[model samples]
Structures are given as C-alpha cells and as structure tokens.
Target: MDAVSKENEVRLRKGTSLNERLVLAGIAVILCLIALPGLAHLANGQWLGIAALFALLFGCLLLGAALFERNVVWIITPGEILIGEQRPFGKLHRRLIRDDEVSGMRLRKSIGKSVEFTLVFETESKDTLTSPPLPDITQVRKTTLQIAWLLQLPAPELAENPLDAANPRIRLGKPISFKRVRAYRALVVLLACSLSLPFIYALWSGKLSALGIAVWSLGAIMAFVLIRYLYRTSAFWIVHDGAIRFERLSLKGTTETDTVSGDDVEAIDVESGGRKDSLYVITIRLRTGKKIRSPPLAGKDQTHAVQAEIIRRLRLNSSGDA
Candidate 1:
C-alpha cells in the first residue's frame, strides 16, 4: 500500500471515538460509586442488602465492558473490505475479503424504523457475514453499496429496508421480531418486581421464616445470573435467499452469530412453555448435531407468529416434530 492508500485506510475506518469511551468510563465509575453503600451493608452482615450485591456485580461488569467495549472496526481499502476486532489483552480476529470473494449485502431492520440495523454479507460459497447491529445505517449503506458495486452484486435499497413497510408475505415470510426496546425493558422490570415482592413483604412484616429466607436467596441468585441475559436485546434471525442467519449481542457486548446453510438444517422445532404467559422458544437442529435456539420468545402471540413464519420460509411447515 502506498502513502496515499495508507491515509485512505485511516480515513475509512469506522472507529470508537475517545469521547464515547470516556462517557462509558464515567458511567462505569458512577455505578461503582452507587455500589459502595451496598458493600458497607454486606460488611456489617445485613444480608438484606442483596440488591446491592447484584448492583456491585453489575457495576464491575459495566466497568470491564466500558473499558473494552468496542474494538470491532471496519476498513475499506482500494482492493477489498477488512473487518477486525481486538480481543482481550490485545489478541485480534481479522477477516479480509477481496472484491472477488464479495458476494452480496442487504440491510435488515428487525423492529421497524430503528437506528440499529443488521447488515448481511453473503459469499460465493454461501457463508453469511454480518455486521453487529449498527446505529448509523446511512453511512453503512453508503459503504456497502460502494463495495457491492465493486463486486457486481445487486444493491440493497434503503427504501426497501425491512423497517420500511409491513413485511411482505412468504416466499418472503414476515420476520418474527422482538418488540421495541421499551417493551422489553417494561417486561423485564415487571417480572423483576414480581419476583422480589414476596421477599420485600416478608422483610417488612418481620415474619422471616426459613422458607421465606430461602425464597429470597433463590430470587436474588436468579436475578444476578439471569438479569443480564434477559435485559439484553433479543436475538434476531433473518432469512434471505434460502440462507438463514442469527445474530444477538452477548451480555459482555460482543455479537453472537450462527449461520446454517439452507440444506444443512434438517429440522425446525417449536415448543411452548410457561405459566399463564405462553413462552414459545425455537430450536434449530442441524444434521450435524448442533442445536441453535432463538432468543427466548416471551409472549403468546409473538411465539405463534414467529414460529409460523420461520417454519414456512424453511419449507418444513408440515412437520411438527417438536
């Protein structure tokens, strides 16, 4: 690469800003400060400060996340596109696609009209590569279209984005999507409160029975382990031209993705469970013995709709193996 090329590489990188990192670091500090009183109470043996324990753990995780939150970066060169991430203590995962290996790209919006969008890239061998759900679709689309032209693939139009309209019916089955962020937050908060209520009541009434104490301990453990998974954004599965891709953010801020070629997936399973509220979850079992689950499905209606659509698109609608 020449000097001019090196400068261009620097120019095109989608980078983590210094200000953004500072703000995250600031919030991490604030959370640690908030956890101090909880630690003091725990030191005094007031176990009632279990809420503070969860906070302290969460704060520490935030501090780590803030410190190492964003390392994945995209770079466009004169020849191809490069996507790379700097891992813990500075290990790196890097993939470079020359113009010839580039197949195609599309924009996916799960919950309509949102800042975050999933950009999918397909290779000649049908491998699926995805960008982490990104907030700046405008810039992403511009870069993607440039690359698409270089590879001689069809351009994914912004106006035809998934969020642009009611999802078209199968052959393009409407995607089963999680509700917007606010809805998920509300549901999580409501459940957390309900779980905590029994302990809170017992604490107030001064009737701390052995069973009551056990219940509180169980609830606290559940909250500490499950809250991160629950409160995080739901994973999304997108199917395009017979290839299916799944993407979600891990609690630690890395993207989790799984892709199965259309032919490799031998079965689609949908099972329903839950008390009063119907919880339907999906598991995709491959001929290779791998099982992939969709982000937990929370509501009755969403479960039904998503199951129907995914099965339909996969052309296994007639089989009810689960």
Candidate 2:
C-alpha cells in the first residue's frame, strides 16, 4: 500500500474501557474468595473432595477470564477488519479479514424488534464462522455497509436516506453503550436474593438457625457484588472516525474502524420492538442488496439517535464529496 493508502487504513481506534476490566477482576476475586472456604471444608469427606474439585474448576475459569480481558480490541483498516477476543485460557483470539472475502451482510430484526443480529462475510469455502453479538446496533450496520460498499466498484440504486422523515444526525461527542449482564447472571442474582430474604426475615423474628442465616447472607452478598461489578464494568464506544467498538471487561471485545466511505452506503434503518414500549434494533441495508445488524437492541430513543447520526454523517460526506 502507498503512503496515502496506509494513512487511510487507520480510520478508527476504539478500546474497551478500564471500568470493564476492573469488573472482571472483581468478579474473579469474589469467585475465588467464595470458593476457597468451601473447597477447604470438603477435605474430610469423599463427596467434599469432589465438590472441592468442582470449586477449583470454577475458580480457574473465572480467573482465566479476568486475565484474558486485556486482549480485547477492534480495529478496522482500509482493506480489512480485526477483532480481538478473550478466550477461556490466557490465549488471545483474533479474526482478521478483507472486504473482498466477505460474501454478504445483513441486519436481522428480531422479535418486536427488541433484538437485532448481524451476519457478515459468509465464505463459500467455509461452513460457519462465529459472530458475537454486538451491543450497538448502529455500529454493526455502519461496519456492515462499509464493508459492502468497499467490496463493490459501483454503488447500488437504493435510496441513500431510506426514511426521509427521520431527523438528522447530531454528533453526540463519543458514543457510549453499556455492555450489560446477560440472562444467566441476572437469574443467579435474583435467585440468591430471593433465597436470602426469607432467612434474614426469620433471623429477625428469632426463629432462624444461625448457620443457615449465615450461609444465606454470604450468598446474597456475593450475588450483589457480582451483579454490581458486571454493571459498572461493561461498556461500548464509537469515536469520531466512523469506527464501531464493543467490549466487556472480561467477556468479549471487538472494533471496526476505517469503514467504507459514507458515499457508498445506500441506506440505513433504526428499528425497535413491535409494541410501542419495546426495545430497538438498528439495521443498515447496502446498495448491493446486503443488510447488516448492529450488536443488539437498544432503547427506542437511543436507537433513533444513532440512526440519525449515521445518516447525517453520510449526508455531510456527500456534500463535501470527501
């Protein structure tokens, strides 16, 4: 690549926030702390030995996730995209590819538009490729459309702005997205709280067993700590250079910068659930009959905001012919 081409390759830079890394570490520490005492108590019995082994296994898993958190990164270069991910062990997983290799892209609108998924670059030579869920819908669409536009020499006939009535994009400074905890984590917290409440009530009434109450109390504390840690640490971001980034301190991180030029994107859509109160999903359709989905769904207002901003950028790029 020439100097100009190399410069164009560095379109965006996005990283996972430090807050997320702290949360992963916190969760790991709590898991180890909780498991240690339980494992020690099992030394005298055969069943306890087995239980200790399981506890140790769990601890290892959490610790591994915590350490691998540092490997997260999403980078988009002129010819390709790069996603860095955290694996079970201390290994870093990466996916790197160019626009020409991408088969197609589409934005998926899920139930009530409450959820959305993106599909990109399904190669004929391979049966399957793993795609992680992205939290920001607009970024997914932007990345998808950029890839599609970059691959084709000429643009399609689709409308540049599909929804004329929608408002224009207002630069919201830096994009922010919360990489919230998922269903399993929420369920564990809820169950722990539900089980602990009765024990506390019984203790207050002077009818509870002290040992039982202590166990319940400890479990409840762990649950609260874990949930809070997850919430505070999760985040996603998009920066000024048409880049899309997603990261969880411990779970997954991906970034795509140097998107296809705005002039090539044919249309964009911000969608949400069926009912008025449902969540939102953003979809971008390229001129090549390709569609791209954002990471997941967002609130209705947030979805609208991102969609408007992307469209605005596209328009501005056209006016300047940049």
Candidate 3:
C-alpha cells in the first residue's frame, strides 16, 4: 500500500446484475434433467414449450451475468486499483494496480452496438489498459475523474451518451460487453420452441401414443443437447492481476473451477484466429497438466492480448519464465 491508496477510501462498484437468478435457474434446470422425462411425460413440461425455452436459450446470458455479478467489478483505493471477480461462489481473482504505473487516464467510446465511454488507463510506457465496460453513470464517472486527479493525468471528459450513436469519443482496443448478446438468446429460444411445440400439441390432443412418445423422447434429447451447448458456451476466463480463474459448468450438473496463480500457468494459447463465435477459443495450460479453455469471445486479437498480458504478468511475478 502506498500513500495514495492509503488516503483513498476503499470502495467497490457494479452494474445491474443477474447473479443469483442465473445460479438458481441453472440449478433448477440441472435437477430437471434427472429422470424428469422418464418419470413424467416429457417432463410434464409446458415449461419448455413456452416458459423454459427462454431459460435454455439464455443459459449463457445467465452464466455471464452471474460471473459479472460475483466477479466482474472494480475495487478502488487511494494507492492501487483492484480488478477481477469478487464473490463467494467465484474465485476472487484480484489484480492490483499501483499508482506509479498509470501514466494517464482517458474516457474512450467502445466499438459496436450502442457506444459507451469507459475509463482507460495508460501505462508509464504508454501502453493502454482498460477496465470492464462502464456506462454513463454517475458513480463510476466520478471515480474515474477522481482517479485522473490522483494520477495527475488529463481528466476523462464526458461523452454525450456512450450508449448512444452520437458518442464522439476515441475508440481503442477490442471491445467487450458485460452482458452476452441478445440475438443468440433469441435464436436459441426460437429453436427450443420449434422443437417443443409439436410434442406439446400431440400430447394435449391425446394423439401421443407410444410412437409419439418415442418421437417426443428424441426431441427431449435434442433439447438437452442444445441446453448443454448453451451451458458450455457460457464458459470463459476472468484474468486477474496475478492469477486467472476459469468457470466451466455443463448442463449435466457438473462444474469445474480452476484458479491458477501466475506461477502455475505454463502458457496461453488461442485457436481459430480468423473465425468467430464457437470456433474461436482460448486455452491456458497449467504446470499441473490441466488445460483450461474459454468460450468464443469477440475476436482473436482480444484473446491474444489478454493471453499476452496474463503471461507477462505471471512471468514478472514468478521467478521462472512462463
């Protein structure tokens, strides 16, 4: 801790969250898979055709929201900035930013969708650093201004509305959103409903004989496959200052959590450089012979950047090379 960090009152901040909702919903979905179809006709589930379709589709959204709620927040102190996930269910992946490293501060407009300005920090050597996306809210804006004052950098200016089309701010680096895309959810929900309706109609009309039951069972399997896809698609990594945390939960009620210190990570790797979506993935191999992978992120550059930064920090923090 330094004088600046010591003088600053420690505070934590976050945006509107979907944390517990996802956890509980995902848990319910997990339990539903256990003999629900065999015990009850197609899980007796009107839920899937109408109500539950959205649930399966938005599985990634909920997972991402939960990760954001529990982990994705900023903790500011006078001497340093703390970043990463902060929650009991999430491994606390905290990165400490010293006052001396930050050479400047600026407000930047993000790329794509509704543009929003977020606080960015420049290193002494002029390398740019960014925090999680921030909307044009008062508290974070105030904090950014205060940090600029403390760092003796050019203060970040306000943009009209970062989420608006009129955002006239400098754009930098690969953009990331705190939430998943809405279109993916919508698409999934549509598919689920398409699969579910025929079975529901057949059952309601009492036309679902043994043959119909067999058809419904097959449909049920497909729905599970889709749900599992969504669940696994939600997998991702949160890069902390000196550590990394990966979350992988399947639709089958199985979860794997890995919190690896910088010293333990052997390397970071990315695949499908030019591709997007599920085809693009990031992998981190640890010294312990375990390899962790990330879901499809925006682009290869972003993955590579995060990987390089983590590996660099890990090497710096560790006595041996990464």
Candidate 4:
C-alpha cells in the first residue's frame, strides 16, 4: 500500500504484495501440471478422471484470480472524490462523488478488533460510500483527514453512536438461538477430495512413480485436514432471561457456556457496510467497557430484529428491578 500526493490531486493504491502474488502463481502452476495427466483419461471415457480434471482446472482458475486480485485506488481532488478498482485486464470500475453531495466522512471499526477499519463518506441523501477494509486505522485516519481537507469537508472522527432502539419492544416468547454453521467448510472439503481423486486413481492403478507417491501423500493429508475442518464443533448464541449466553459444543460431547447479564449492558451497536444484505455484527457494550459481539449475521432486518429484542429484554429487567 502506498499514497502519492501532487499539487492538483492525491492518489492511494493498495493490492496484494509481490510475495503473496508469487505464492498464488506457483500454486496455480502446480494445479495446471496436475491436470495434464487427467487429460489422457478424458479419451478413456472415465467419469472420475473427467471430474478430477475439471476440479483441477477450476482450482487453477481460482488461484489465478487470487494472483491478479483487483487493486483498490482512491483519487481525491478539489472538485470530487474518485474510487476505483483496477482489474488485472486493465479495466477500471470507478465511481465519482462530487464535493456538494458529500456531507461528512467518518472512520468505523469492525466488531472483533479495532485493527480493521473503514472510511465512510456520508452523503446528503443518506447514502454512503465506504472504502474497503484496511488493517491500519492510523493510515486510514491520515488518508481520511487528507481527503477531507482536499474536499473542504469536516475532519473525520470515529463513528461510535449506538444504534437506535427506540422502536416498540419486540416480545420473545421463547429463547432466541442462532447457530453458527459455515457452509463454505463443506465446500472446501468437497473441492479437496475432488482434487485428490486423480492422484488416488493413479496410485491405485500402479502407474504412480516415487514422485507421484509423494504428491499423492500430500493430497491425502490435505483432504484429511479439510474433512476435519468440515466437521469441527461450532458455537451458538442464545438470548434468554435478560442475558446472552454463548455455548460451544465440543466433538467429545462436552458443552461450555458463558453468560453476560443485561444489568451491565450499556448499549447495543451494529457494524456493517450500510447495505440491506450486508453482514451485521451486533455488539453488546458493558458498563465496564467490555464488548461482546455476535457472529456475523446476514441481512439488516434479521440483525436489527435481534438487537431490538435484546434491548427490550434489558429494559424489562431494569423496570422490574425498579
């Protein structure tokens, strides 16, 4: 990541590092090499070989995409702010926001850690233009200040207001539970097994040399690791009786629970990309300055609903004590 400033304009650019790109390119090359043997099996009309070949090629394509990931760039001038993503093919997808349209800018931190931050431009129309997540908040803050000065806008500050919960309380007749099950883990296991099929076949057919055996061994280990990841125990959240509970079920059938009482709750805030379908992180702030966050929940409506109910329960508890 680097920034360049000139008399008329300032430019900020960020992308994958050279070492990261080289690693992805190397993996892509290996996948292509693995696909070569599967090509010969295509003439034999073998279904397994065909599936393996497709999987290998698909993996290569995915790696290639990673190797040439789109680079994010921001150009700030006296009149307007331009945000663009430069693709590997030299195509740029850009958006322009004139100075008149932007009301202010703010920095927002992600739920889990303060390291990840986003710079958001608030428009007069209630719409927002947000920068990609950047790990260094200091850098983001500096860039935000520079842009605000260039655009003649207010200095950016951290956005930390709690989400409004003044709507009618939502009654929960029973405990609300949210389960965490990542479907992507299963997809990864499937892909790993598919990529290993050809090597397994080659070994079974006694056509594998010493080098082939090593590659097959590595594939087997990778498949095992992915399978384990797919079946790993997961945690869930339960909101009930004026408290939020986190429970994790272990593979050995043991369950652990931790609870946070509503009495200590200070506020309920949400972090998101300001989109209806964007993932929302609901954070519970305590009087002690502690924060308990829910896992990334999909959709604005669902997350806001949960937030409202939690606030409702907290109020009910406070009223009862009075």
- Which candidate wins on TM-score? 1
For candidate 2, the lDDT comes to: 0.51
Model 1 scores a C-alpha lDDT of 0.59
Model 4 C-alpha lDDT per residue in residues 120-166, reported as the tens digit of each score? 88899999877665432224445556667788888876453222122
User: Model 3, 1-322: lDDT tens per residue?
Assistant: 0012223543444443355556655775564454243333335655445444444445545555545445356666665777766664557777777778887777776656223346788777777766655532223455566666655567767654421212222112223332342345557768878877887898899887898788778776776666556555555555555666666654554555667787687667777634545345556677888877665544443444444555554554322347
| Overall local distance difference test of candidate 4 | 0.65
- Predicted model with the maximum lDDT: 4
Question: How many backbone collisions does model 4 have?
Answer: 0
How far out, in Å, is residue 245 in model 3?
Answer: 2.3
Candidates' C-alpha lDDT: 0.59, 0.51, 0.56, 0.65
**What are the per-model numbers of colliding residue pairs?**
0, 14, 9, 0
Q: Candidate 1, which segments miss by more than 4 Å at Cα?
A: 1-15, 43-48, 87-93, 132-144, 157-322
Whichever of 1 and 2 has more lDDT, that candidate is 1
- Per-residue lDDT of candidate 2, residues 41-129 (tens digit): 57676676567668677877866655664444445566666767653355677777666665554444443443444333455455344
Candidate 3's TM-score: 0.38
- Total clashing pairs in model 1: 0
Error of 1 at 226 (Å): 37
Superior candidate under lDDT, 1 versus 4:
4
